[model samples]
Target: MKQKMIDVSIHLFDKKGFTETSIQEIVDELGVTKGTFYYYFTNKQELLTTIHLNFIEFLLKKQEEILQDEAKDSREKLRAMIYMVLQSINERKKSARIFFREMRNLGPKYLEQNVEKRDQFRKNLQQLVEEGIHKGEFQEDLHADMVTRGILGMTNWSYYWYNPEGDVSAEELTDIYVEILLNGINKSD
Candidate 1:
């Protein structure tokens, strides 16, 4: 029942802005009474917070798993992380859209927790970049912080325009991004 409300709310929040979506709409979509929603979530903002947490937590867990793998180099881990996000776009497109687009609607307490998780994701990636540089896998002169942000900007923006069902598979897009990151597009004469 709780999951049903969340799934319905995600669709509603995606189609209608978070501020524009009402509790009644969610319950009506689920064909349940408002009491059922209140039983699981205190209010709409709490539900949104849960949605945000669920998305980021899944990402954090995947990142942690990739980071812990001993066989993969930093470059391989980076590719895995990128592919994980892109694949999520394929599997959870509506959730991704809502996660990115509806963030501003979160209340202060909710926003704080969400921002903390987001920061953790960025910091973890930055650490990966720093590790790559230390191991000579990446350029020594590169700015780890900037590189992390660049990776995130390149991937996260895809929710707005990337077509998971289009000609480019997530694996192919991952390859393209990894190629661009590891080797720039300039032609060498």
Candidate 2:
């Protein structure tokens, strides 16, 4: 039931702008009463908040799984994180779009709360960059926070244009991104 609501929110928000999607529209689509909607969410904003928090929580949990895998070395961990992101985007692709792209209508209060989760994701990436640099796998002077933003900027931007019907599989896409991440644009020996 919770997942159903999340799905409805994603579909409705994607098809229509967040500011334009009303609770009645969602209720009508779900064939549920206003009271039913209220039970799961106080209002549209609350439902949006739930969706945002759930996505961030899901991402953090998966990241924990990859980062805590001691069987892998630092570079492997970094690669795993990148792969995990692609996998997550593939699985939760629609919800991710709603969580990331549609949350501005959530107002500053809710958005501020959600920012903590965003910051945690950044911190996780920053730590990985720092670790990679420590091991001489990445630029030693790599600005961990800056690199974190760069990696996120590159990966998250895919949501705007990534296609399930596209030529590259998600794994292939992850590999492509990783190669560029590790080797960068400069030619090497």
Candidate no. 1 TM-score? 0.97
Q: What do the candidate models score in CA lDDT, each in turn?
A: 0.90, 0.83
Which stretches of model 2 miss by more than 4 angstroms? none
lDDT tens digits by residue: candidate 2, 56-131: 8999998988888889877788788887887777677777888788778788878998998889988988887898
Model 1 root-mean-square deviation: 0.9
User: Model 1, 61-176: lDDT tens per residue?
Assistant: 99999999999999999999999988876588888888898888887978999999999999999999999999999999998899999999989988889996789989999999
Best candidate, lDDT-wise?
1
Per model, how many backbone clashes are there?
A: 0, 0
> What are the runs in model 1 whose C-alpha is more than 4 Å off?
none
lDDT of candidate model 1 versus the reference: 0.90
